[model samples]
Target chain A: MSVTVIIAILVVAFLAGMDGILDEWEFQQPLVACTLIGWLLGDVTTGVLFGGSLQMITIGWMNIGAAVAPDTALAAVGAAIWVCGPAHLTVAEGLAIAIPLALIGQGLTVIVRRLVVKLVHYAERSVRQGNLNVITRVHLLSLTLQGLRVVIPTALILLVPTTLMQTFKAGLPHNVVMGLAVAGGLLAVVGYAIVVNMMATKWLWPFFILGVVLAAITALNMIALGLIGLALAIIYVQLQSQTRPPSGPDDEMDELDRELEDL
Target chain B: MTSANNQMPKTLTRPDLFRLFWRSSFEQGSWNYERMQNLGFVYVMMPAIKRLYDTPEDQRAAVLRHLGFFNTMPYMQSTITGVVANMEVQRANGSQLDDQAINNVKVGMMGPLAGVGDPIWWGTFRPVLAAFAAGLAQGKASLIGPLLFFFGWNIARLTFRWQSQKVGYSLGVTITTKTGNLLPKLTQGASILGMFVMGAVIPRWTSIEMPTVIARVHAHDQLEQLTLQNVCDRILPGLVPVLLTLICLWLIRKRVNPIWLMLGILVLSIFGYSIGLLGVK
Candidate 1:
């Protein structure tokens, strides 16, 4: 890639990473990131295809509080750039590459978080010393550092020779690759389960079972199941509200006021 | 109170603004003006600003006016408005809005914003675009697929950001009005369309093949026309992939670390590949 292309790729990566840090929706997703990378590499088709598959596999993935999900954006984008570039690798092959890349990206994120903590502490000290300029510098430094964490790895992957990648691919055993695929598929179910478990309500279990059955029958995808889930959630909330007995007049009025207040 | 007299009221530097933007942007999970003021850059700058120049009441008010609209995060317009209101009250009291106070507002806003934003953008908007992109990718017009994907996502992001800020500043009401409710319906429709495209892409994209197996329907009737698709579809239509996903789900429920799951997959894939059970081309 030319310097301009490289710069463009890094800029996209920065924006994508920033989106992730900000926890924006689809922009932080692997599907979007890979597609952007693919567009940059001049093979949006392969990129979108691979990205969509990865997105489905990781659809229910999330980062709750301190827990972090695998960095799918890095995996999808890295693999897309690798496969859809001059290498001309197939989508399946790109997917295989994405698995490990995602893992590595997660590790890199953990390290970045650890490093950022120190910077945050320094920023706190700057605040105490009444140095707003230094504090601002530190905050910018953290964002830049986070961006670099993604950009550096991506640059290295992009710069690597095709022959090396080919050799790595050649050395892998066939059954192991198959097993990994099987394993990858299985992990997706777990991802879905985690989401379901988080939103665990008795009535919602039907939707979960329905999701499993629909998925088994190949009659529905996550989106369909999610819609059904949403409907059931609304119904459940409505029923719960209606069935609850009202307390005495004053208490009931207070409860009613609180409910109205929340709205 | 004297500390309030120390700082300057200059417009923020570019880098400070960038940091402030990002800090506030990340807090999109909940928007409040108070939280925006205490964001990493803004929080740090307040005390320093007091030390550097004497910030008059109007200057403080002016600095706060724009800060109230600084919602870099999508779907957080309502909470940002609340924060802005809180900041206006606190600044008027002559109390320095510190980092902790800013973070407290952030912590308050994130949960509600996340509750609202996640479903709207992640569960709804994303799947809609993915459907179109997936359809395009599967067709011969693959190159256009990504372009379409970017166009849809950027359009949403830019439009949402602009609208959210405007709503926060002008309307000063929750942005999740009647319009927000329409997105899930749209998303559901798009998801159904995407699923159909995905069905076609499965066999086309993957190297799924099965060994020739013999089936005897009658005495002397041996059949050897079975392929992977036949086995996969016959078992449960999409059993192979679904079964694979279930196994992973089981492990995840068991609380096995994802790293271990990945490692296990890598090792198993190599073994399966070597044993000729799984084929890759």
Candidate 2:
């Protein structure tokens, strides 16, 4: 690859790493990051082709509380680099490369997050001293460490000969690769599980069941279902609120209890 | 600190609000296992902290006070930041709201907001838009898929981040005063809608089609077996995914660590595939 392309990859990787944590722009996500990498490599087509599918698989992976999900930034960028750049693998093979990389990326994120805790202590120190600049710099520095979490690994991977990966791909067994694909499909359940678990309440089980049945049985579009849901929610909220007596702290607390099942 | 004289020392300028809004986007950057996003939370409110506390000790206390455990839905945090900023301003004006109360509000709002926000934004909004975008890419508009998702999600969310803060600031203390149980009612409303959308879409995203069939059965010509998917559809369409989701729900209620459950799903999938019980759609 050209030096400028390498620089572009590094720059994008750094931003993606930081964005992974920020989650503001979501530049770290496959759809955006891979597209950018592909554009940089003059292979925007393949970059997007794989990025689209990867986005669906990793869409639900997020940091809920202190637990970090798989690192989308690292996996997305790393897979894109391999697929769009030297290795030039097919989208399916690129996905196989990307999926396992998610586990590695998850490890890196947890470690980086732990390492950043020391910086948080420093930030605390800076706060005690009443130095806003120092504290802000520390926070940004912590963010940079996260950036390097992806950049350094990506640079190291780039150092290896692309031919080696090609050879490695050739040697990989079909079942194992197929297994990874199946793993990707199954991983969707985890994402849905977490969401369902969050939204699942004793009174709400019927709604969950209703959603599944509608999706399975009918050819209704997503927007149509969303509209149906909006209608159901409005009707329920209106009827329920009207039936309730004057609002009290106890009543609010009970509603809030139903709000937090896991908590 | 009580709101002495019922007036603030200073009003935040537009630039300050703009700066705070921008900074709030990185509110999870310094996330740590011990205190979660506490430092990032403090960092985002630095503008407000600096504006409110002129004395070094006051500023120090202000910063340190926010450096406790804080986590919330990323996009929805702007409201908290805005409300907290206003409270800090009130505190600086010498309000009765002490550090403990401020922290209490911060701590209290996050969970309920997280409960409401996680499902609405991350759970529903994201998956719906993203799946569509991904679907578009799988179709003729491959490039447009990423473009649409990138622009659609970012524009929608960034606007939300900006606007919610404005709404929070405008509503400010009135949230506790003017509206009794309004937040809860809103939470109830939001969650219901969330469940509705979730109901319609969960089955579609969740794939648990059964390709397995009875083995060693003789029928039409050689060996024939009942199609499990057909049977499932006859009983209830999308039964497998729904049942699978419920099983996951049961496991989660049983206090299974989510990460372990995720790994378990992976292992189960591998085993299921190897044993010819599960196949990828």
Among these predictions, the greatest TM-score belongs to 2
Give the 10-residue window scoring lowest on summed lDDT in candidate 1 chain A. Answer: A184-193
Candidate 1, after superposition: displacement of residue A13 in Å? 3.0
Please give the distance, in angstroms, between residue A58's alpha carbon in candidate 1 and its true position after superposition: 3.6
Name the 10 consecutive residues with the lowest summed lDDT in model 2 chain B: B1-10
lDDT of 1 by residue, B180-243 (tens): 5444444333333233323322322223333433343333565446555566667654456445
lDDT of model 2, residue A191: 55
> Model 1: which docking level applies?
incorrect
- Report how large a share of the reference interface contacts model 1 reproduces: 0.20
Q: Candidate 2, A248: how far from true, in Å?
A: 12
**For this target, which candidate reaches the highest DockQ against the unseen true structure?**
2
Identify the runs in model 2 with alpha carbons over 4 angstroms from their true place.
A177-186, A217-219, A247-263, B1-9, B53-58, B94-101, B202-237, B252-281
Q: DockQ for candidate 1, please give it.
A: 0.22
Q: Which 10 residues in a row give candidate 2 chain A its minimum summed lDDT?
A: A183-192
lDDT of 2 by residue, B1-281 (tens): 44346554766788999999999878888877788888888888889877767678888888888888988888778988888888887777766788899899888778877766776777667766776677677455378889888889889988988997987787875664554456566666656656665565555655554677754567778876766765776787656666666687688779875556656666676677677776766
